[model samples]
Target: MNATNSQSPTIVLVHGALTDASVWHGVIRLTQAAGHHVVAPSLPLRGLASDAAYLESVPGPIVLVAHSYAGSVISHPATLDPKVKALVFIAAFQPDAGESSAELNERFPGSKLGPATTTVVPRPGGNDMYLKPEAFGEVYAGDVAPDVVSVMAAAQRPIDPAALGETLPARATWHDLPSWALVSTRDLSLPPQLLGFTARRAESHIVEVESSHAVPVSHPREVTEVVLEAVRCALS
Candidate 1:
């Protein structure tokens, strides 16, 4: 039932802040049903360098896909693995060399992920940030079912505040890799305008979907289609 050939790239799905790899559940199911091998890894969300290094360790010949803050993770120079053929960003950040996710998230005016919407918990190394359960649906997944949003909010993973401020390395993988982006028109966590700007700045092929920042969850079919497109282009 595998649709991919031996030469086809593996799909590596990276999740972002406030959520874990489970965010890609539907996308993984769809992608796998299409016969492609897929891996959605839980990022440490400690900082950009460490997170990128962890992602770099995944076996490759990969079509790397990232969501929200994970855009910064996959774009790190450390992830410039030769086997990584393409990058797919889903309502994600695509920070430049000196840019940080925090900076980019502020570039446009629409993000509702500020202090009032989130809670800060002091951890051993740094502050951990979480979206308040009440704010999760409106800010991160407005299009998703209330019941599903409830579980997502309860199971959400907190990310180190430091990770949002860490800048990318001097070089970025998008600088050399072919990339595609899916911009969520209804995203409130990362402004849709910010997403479009970053996507164009990377010269990435773009697709627009109507969903929340949790596009992978609310619109998995669209996300999977974009990933499959990247795979097709990479194989071509």
Candidate 2:
């Protein structure tokens, strides 16, 4: 777990639905500038278990950072390698055993938090879907600038809806790991209060930023600070 040794906690960036790892470009550069290695993986988004497994496959100093739907991916029951230091959630879901995004959203029906149209659909190919651009911005990037939202929105990939529906079998990750959460004040997709609830649920060290759901892009400085803090806390 020492940087000098074989392991150094590299930040593993997990993008939200309908987007690729590139969505983290700005944040990645920022993190690297701060002298931390980052890995923003392109998740299959087909199932929570599969996505978590894919992420664990990356190998080496990994710290799980799940955005939006990928939260479920990190909270999976199986242990992500011991090399993983901690988790950073960017307006991401933080769930327990037997929970799914659909079940969680059901708690807040008809959320103005999301876009006028929802792109989270049934499996595009098999068990995943992606959020549409309008929904991506209106719901996910409402706080982000129009231009940034446009580009990040266009780069989004489709995720399978099954990922949303897939419930967690083991909630150990939530309880076992040390957690940090960055709340996007202007997020329309999940609603601000929902994020607050998440902070409380995970008992995380909460940091609220005046950004959109895409906090990593909308507020890279703030995001970088939190990430840096996580690294220090982990190594300490």
Candidate 3:
């Protein structure tokens, strides 16, 4: 699975809360054009342990790319599947062991994702959280076009409330993997400061881009570049 090998490693793009795998559409196109295989799996948005277990089941020799809440999901040590050689966090949370994504989000104060910007729908066992459509563009995709933001708003996914508070069960896998991160400087969903803090703590190769929380859609080229860099470094 190293760079010298004939087969290219897979690039698994994982989306975070309030979005689905479609969030990786642009990144997938670019990465695929560059001759790499890419897959964006739809996370169930359940609690952390279950979500990480689901991610672990994806076939590997992989460059795992995570956006937003998926950061916490991939941070689980169980996701350290032997073939997951690298981690790329795109404006995402990279929590340490015993830390929850909610905790990380509040660690720094610029996040605008509070009750005013979100809605909670009660499901049988827990609550599902969604970004309010009217606030989605401002809070999650401010840099994107209005029409595209409308479509994204309509298609946004809801995450279980438990996912936010669910603590990482063991050590962060990033501690054992080569990692990279993109800090969305203008991001309003998760504060850019929080992103910087976690990325620095993980010692990931970091890039700062002026984007909304939706960096994959707003700055796909930069996102793709980071993912490709991780692939090159991890495989080499």
Q: Which candidate's TM-score is highest?
A: 1
Give the clash total for candidate 1: 1
lDDT sort, best first: 1, 3, 2
Q: What is the C-alpha local distance difference test score of each model?
A: 0.93, 0.74, 0.91
Worst 10 residues of 3 by lDDT: 1-10
For residues 1-236, write the lDDT of model 2, one tens digit per residue: 12232235878888877677876788888777666777787887677788878876777667788788887788787645577788888888887888897677657533453334654444335743456666667767677788877887777687766678888886548687788988877776666777788778889999998876777777777877887788788888
TM-score of each candidate structure, all chains considered together? 0.98, 0.88, 0.96
Cα RMSD, model 1: 1.0
Candidate 1 TM-score, true structure as reference? 0.98
Give the range where candidate 1 is weakest over 10 consecutive residues by summed lDDT. 1-10
Off by over 4 Å in 3: 1-6
Span of ten consecutive residues with least summed lDDT in model 2:
1-10
**Displacement of the residue 13 alpha carbon in candidate 2, Å:** 0.8
Expressed as tens digits, the lDDT of each residue in 135-179 for candidate 3 is 999999999999999999999889997889999888899999999
